[model samples]
Target: MPPITPRKPQRRALLIGICYKHTHQDDWPELLLTHRDVDRFRALLRSRYDYADDEITVMKDDEAVPSRLWPTAQNIRRELDRLVRGTAAGDQLVLLFCGHSDQLDTEETKDKTEEDGQDEVIIACDAKRIVDNELKYRLVTSLHAGVNLTVRVLSLS
Candidate 1:
């Protein structure tokens, strides 16, 4: 048998949790434990998967600092762009989102994809709605070939 090569896949993770500090149309309840959930997942990534602290980008509403970005729709899109830019073949990217989700009617029905004619969205800290199609276009379609991307979304609503 020939010599075997070790599998050391390049792993990257983006963890986002929104507690909805502000709201617009709906009186959404604030999530007390969503931030904790992301923290726990971060721990798991480090202890179980050996992910470095610098390798993870955390965007939380209550825990937002100057260095760490906030969980806004614009920020999320920008981060997704950054992740796709840094990703290469055989690289692993994990995205985790914990917040409120809602189903809304989408325009441009000619290219409608959702089965129920309504688009699922993740509400951001600024009360902005990020449609599922937008996520797929920015994160999924932008990934390079052979890149492993996993998205975990935990919706409180």
Candidate 2:
């Protein structure tokens, strides 16, 4: 029998961290570590895992570069689509969300409800909430065969 060769896995990642600085007034305190954590993670991925700079997208609330991506619902959705859609069979997808997340348990919605009766949400930089169910539908459900998907949530509040 001929020896089998292992295929190299294609790597893609989306990193989101929000401090919610300009969103609200003195009501909710800002997160101090989220942005730095994302930076560290990005650096690690680039240095250790051999992931290219273009292969990873970083979205933060206080991003100074206007040309760079920000953490918004539409932007996140678009990047998620790109990461998932462009993946092949031996690809690896990494999604890391670090910031304020919410749990909404409302009886008003008809279609989207979680098993615990509370819908999980990730609060974006633009103060938009992206539901977990919507994420599942958009990113998870459309995963190609043999693609390895890993999701990590680091919530500070």
Candidate 3:
């Protein structure tokens, strides 16, 4: 008789990317890579699936109006928790992050290292680099500590 192995459950996907522009000439390598990677991933998930505009949240870097803390990483984590704690079982939940992935371990800023930090930090219209760590993953321990929902990350730049 063949032994049976348990299969991991799957959830819905939430995709986020920050491309276009980031740094200057000296930082071209990282910047260029980030853009290409983000573009590739965005095109992947957004193809063939007809999802409502709200279902798919997009945060892009614009010279005019970029995303701040509220609508950036905070929004992403909030949405993830809402789904995990809500009665949406059997329903898929996916979280996709695209950009430059870095390790933020400095005590001063280590606590808050989401996609918005170091990765998608852009010169917003208000001139602020969004911090990702502010999101309350502590209240909902099931997230960054490898909790509920499916997380997919792709880096082009």
Please provide, for model 1 over 111-131, each residue's C-alpha lDDT reduced to its tens digit, 9 standing for 90 to 100: 376777888888888888888
Predictions in order: lDDT: 0.82, 0.81, 0.45
| 1-157 per-residue lDDT for model 2 (tens digits) | 9998866778899998878786683433688898898999999999999899988988887749353477777888887888898666889899999888877775544444456777778887777788877899888899888999999999844
Task: State how far residue 125 of model 1 sits from its true place (Å).
Answer: 0.2
> Cα lDDT of model 2 overall?
0.81
Higher-lDDT candidate of 1 and 3: 1
Candidate 3 TM-score over all chains jointly: 0.46
Candidate 2 all-Cα RMSD: 3.8
Model 1 — TM-score against the truth?
0.85
**Could you tell me how far off, in angstroms, the CA of residue 4 lies in candidate 3 after the best superposition?**
35
Clashing pairs in 2: none
TM-scores, all candidates, are 0.85, 0.86, 0.46
